[model samples]
Target: MSKVLIIFIKNPVAGKVKTRLAATVGDTTAVEVYKNLLHHTQNITHLMAADKFLFYADFLQREDEWPNEQFIKHLQKGNDLGKRMHHALEQVFLNKYKNVLIIGSDCFELTAAIIEEAYLVLEDKNIVIGPAKNDGCYLLGMKNPQPCLFKNVSWSTSQVLQQTISICTREHLNDCLLPTLTDIDDENDLSVEQKIYFKLKKSAQ
Candidate 1:
């Protein structure tokens, strides 16, 4: 089946991204961390064979790591996170793709292999979800737009994953769950080896 991968990201703007992390490490450091996360996402997703789309929070950037010709870039629509996501899915589904998956850049552990596996699972199931350790989901995949799954969601809370599953159950949509991974949100969320906050201290000055 034809597949599409949607990646949601913000252009690395200091004081504008990762607000929680910014609170702990300051805006300049948060921007750097987000930049690193975006780089990691680009590297991991570069090898995938499916059609890829980068949904930007603001305007598009052509000079970034993701070559303009390689991934289709679009600005995210709607007023809230859930609405934006639902709109993207609706638009993609209207285009007649057989399988679609959306992921955020927050999960550093996400890999191309896991993404491929989600697409594979979509061959049988209508939905595939990768649960995050924070009770939020890292990745969500589906064959068609199921708008109910995106509604009434408590974004950024510990109940996100559970609420999504409950909606799925209510709708009787067949689904498969992937392994859980941690998404960086707070300063404590970063692994010691990945700590590059020190690098931003000088720039912030």
Candidate 2:
């Protein structure tokens, strides 16, 4: 069975994306930053994975803007963050892939090796989580579709990782955790990590 990778991204429209960061960096800058993040994510995924898809917030009107012609681009359809992710995974599993890995664009430390490691862990574990320093997760992978792992959980909060762990425990699922990494979400979160933020800014430019 083929391994699949689903990249989750929002429309990088000014004043619509990254609202928290827009409060400090302005809408225009936030949009530009989000675009750069998408570019970086696409680059890394293209280099590492063979089967990839873009789980976009909005449907793409122009095909030229998207990278791979083989990539299956689909609009996310769900009420909340958790539901959207769950729905995306369900779709991927329905495609007959053996393992599916989903990642967000905010994480700078995410690399091809990290993704490959997650795929490797799926052989023995039911779920593999790449935890973020902010107590969230950058990546989530599973061998099968399991919506219970995402049900009724608080998203975009510091307790996100903990809540996911609780869900896994309750379901008796075997889970593997990777080393913690940082993700750029808000101004305060960036302030403490000036070096990484500036590095990303420079790379974006």
Candidate 3:
């Protein structure tokens, strides 16, 4: 079974990435912070044993200078947030990966071990979710593509996680929830980045 990691990212342009954080930290700093988050995610994903890693970006044609060899970069398709994620997952599964996991670039606490755990959970569970502290989800995994869970989801809101769970229940899909995690979306979430940075800095010494 091939394990796949799909990272949904945005062009870390000023005033584009981390809009909420931008309000607090200024657009330039927010973009820098967002870039750090993306780097963190890329580093962790590279440490995993996945057969394929897909970096799906919002703007298809806008090419920023990211590390090319880090992952397979692809432009995200679909109208809304939910649809884009669904489309990306569907394409990856259609291409023949057995276990696929999708994640965002904002979770500073995401580690190789957590990703490995999600892959393991997918061995027995149809759907796996790593819930976020803000009532959203940082990671979602599946044995195969299931579009229903991503359909009609209220994206960018507190109801996201609940709506996903509701969809799972409505469709009778076997689901597993991993330990709660945090994503850097607002001013409060900035602490997560500091903590991760300091932890890594200490470990490096």
Candidate 4:
């Protein structure tokens, strides 16, 4: 029974990674913030007992903190967010991973425990989603590949979580919901106790 974790991320370029955050803080600050998020995610996921795959949003980084021995890197395919996610999961399922989980690099509250829990929930539930406190979701997992959950849903909108739930209900898929967590999308999201932390830290640096 092979389990796999797929991480979706963009290259941590100055003006590319977190556009909304960049809008609030300058581009350099946004880059620094994104790098911190990446480092945090990498540290947590590195300890998980599963095959890890890093799907870059655009190009692949051959020389980075993600040591080549630990992660199998690839470029993300498809035309939109939904299709790209579906494709990544689909490829892993095709590669024979029974338990598959996919996550983005935006959620500050994501922990190794939550990821481990997702793997466990997939033991019975057909799907598990870690909903963001805002309009989107942070993590999505499946016992087996079900690309239907990624379809017919709006991307980058406040209604994403609701729309995904509707699709799950319509498809009759048994879904488990994890505790909602804060995802860093805009200034308002960081204001949840993290704005001060990030700002002060940036000031010192």
| lDDT, ranked from best to worst | 1, 4, 2, 3
Measure candidate 2: CA RMSD. Answer: 3.1
- Compared with the true structure, what per-residue lDDT tens digits does model 4 show for residues 35-130? 888988998999788999999998999899998999999999999889999989888888878879999998778999999999989999998999
Best by TM-score: 4
lDDT of 1 at 45: 89
Candidate scoring better on TM-score of 1 and 4: 4
Model 4, runs deviating above 4 Å: 191-193
Residues 26-82, candidate 2, lDDT per residue (tens digit)? 776677767877877877787665588788887664464566475678888888889
Clashing pairs in 3: none
Q: Write down the TM-score for model 4.
A: 0.94
Worst 10 residues of 1 by lDDT: 195-204
List the global CA lDDT of all models.
0.88, 0.83, 0.81, 0.88
Pairs that collide, model 2: none
For candidate 1, the lDDT comes to 0.88
lDDT of 3 at 124: 89
Residue lDDT tens for model 3, 36-110: 887898778775677545655655532444455656778888878888888888888888887888999899899
TM-score of each: 0.93, 0.89, 0.88, 0.94
Model 1 Cα lDDT, one tens digit per residue, 53-153: 89999888877889877798888998888898998888888889978999999988999999999999999999999999889989999988898997889
How far residue 153's Cα lies from its native spot in candidate 4, in Å, is: 0.8
How much is the lDDT of residue 186 in candidate 3? 72
